[model samples]
Target: MTKIPAISLRRLSKSFGDLDVLGVMDLDVGRGEFVSILGPSGCGKSTLLSILSGIEEATTGEITIHGAPLNQSGQPFAWMPQNDALLPWRTVVDNVGLGYQVAGRLSKRAARDQARLLLPAFGLEEFSRALPYQLSGGMRQRVALARTIAQGRDMLLLDEPFGALDAITRTELQLWLEQIWGVDRPTVILITHDVREAVLLSDRIYVFSDRPAQIVAEFEVPLDRPRTIEMLAGAQATQLELDLLRALHVGSGDTP
Candidate 1:
């Protein structure tokens, strides 16, 4: 039996006045699959995500989630942007529970209670009362992630969630995220600039072209999971990375 895709995009396009950001693009993400959109800085990756999340409208397209048209009531996706975007005045617990409160699905106290229970899993139990100003960048992102997870959505749209972090911290968080996603198996669509990050974290990767962005190539990562950074050191991984790099270079109108 074929499983219907968790999300689908057909003839999706976005424009800003005379400038086009995303050309007519078609994509699909299967249930429980980790997919990545790998592209350059301004290739409209975030724009596509915004459209999926209903933060922005597409100029022309058909978007479906779980076989239903977009905006059909219960949200099929949750979004995590490039920045942590935690509230400065809110404590860690409060920040992590804001989603539930905002949804009116739970009271603030109930939301905090839920956040408190989940904080230990995120390694944030000790800092429940800490303000955003008191936490490191990595910790703040953890709180943000906890908030996103608190929503219990089955699909996640991550726009370079670890893009702003340092190398070591990013690696640590990526491992932690992979572990969490492995357990939950939420369908994920991640937008990223790092080739290795996409290869490491995704089941399949779509490399996008320059402006008026569209998928130029796609590759499946054949490695089995519970994947670690150490696996990326092998010959196959190196060649795959080189291939992705070449695709990006070629997509940008440069000879690889």
Candidate 2:
């Protein structure tokens, strides 16, 4: 039996006036699969994400979710962006629960109640009262994840969610994300250029071309479950890295 994709992009194109960003791209994210869009700086990775999220409208093509059109809702599913973007005025608990607060889906107490229990799981038990400014860059992102998770979004669109953190902290959070997201795995579409990060985290990766990007290649990481940083540091990681490098070579106009 074939599982219907969580999100499908069929010949999708996007442009800003004369500048074309994405050109008739087709992408498939399977149900509960963790997929990453890997490409270069100016290749419109974020633009593609924005178009899919309906934050930026596409010039043509279709983005459908579970047989329904996302054009109707404009913004459906959950979004966790490149920046932590935690509100300065809100404390950790309030920040994590902030989405519910804005949507009026849950009262203040109830939202915080959920955030409080989930905080320690995110290594944020001690900082519930702390403001965003009081925490490190990495700590702030944990709050961001906590907030995103609080929404319990079924399809998560993550744009470099851990891009800003230090190496050690980033590794810590990566493991945390795998654990949390592993349970009740949501259909995830991540935009990242970090090859190892993409390889370590994703089930499959979609590589793109220059400017008006195309799906140059797709590679399934054969690495088994319970993955760790150590796995990425070994020979298997070396081979996977080369595979990713070759796929992304298309982004640089490297013909293979």
Clashes of each: 0, 0
lDDT of 1 by residue, 103-218 (tens): 53899999998889989999999999999999998998898888888877888889898899999999999989988888888899999999989888999999999998989999
Which window of ten consecutive residues has the lowest lDDT sum in model 2? 71-80
Give me the candidate number with maximum TM-score.
1
State TM-scores per candidate: 0.97, 0.93
lDDT computed for candidate 1: 0.89
Which candidate's lDDT is highest? 1
Per-residue accuracy of model 2 over 19-136 as CA lDDT, tens digit each: 9888788888889899988988678888887877668988998988887898675456678888888999999999998866654389899888877988988889999999999999
Q: Candidates' lDDT values, in order?
A: 0.89, 0.83
Candidate 2 deviant stretches above 4 angstroms: 72-75, 254-256
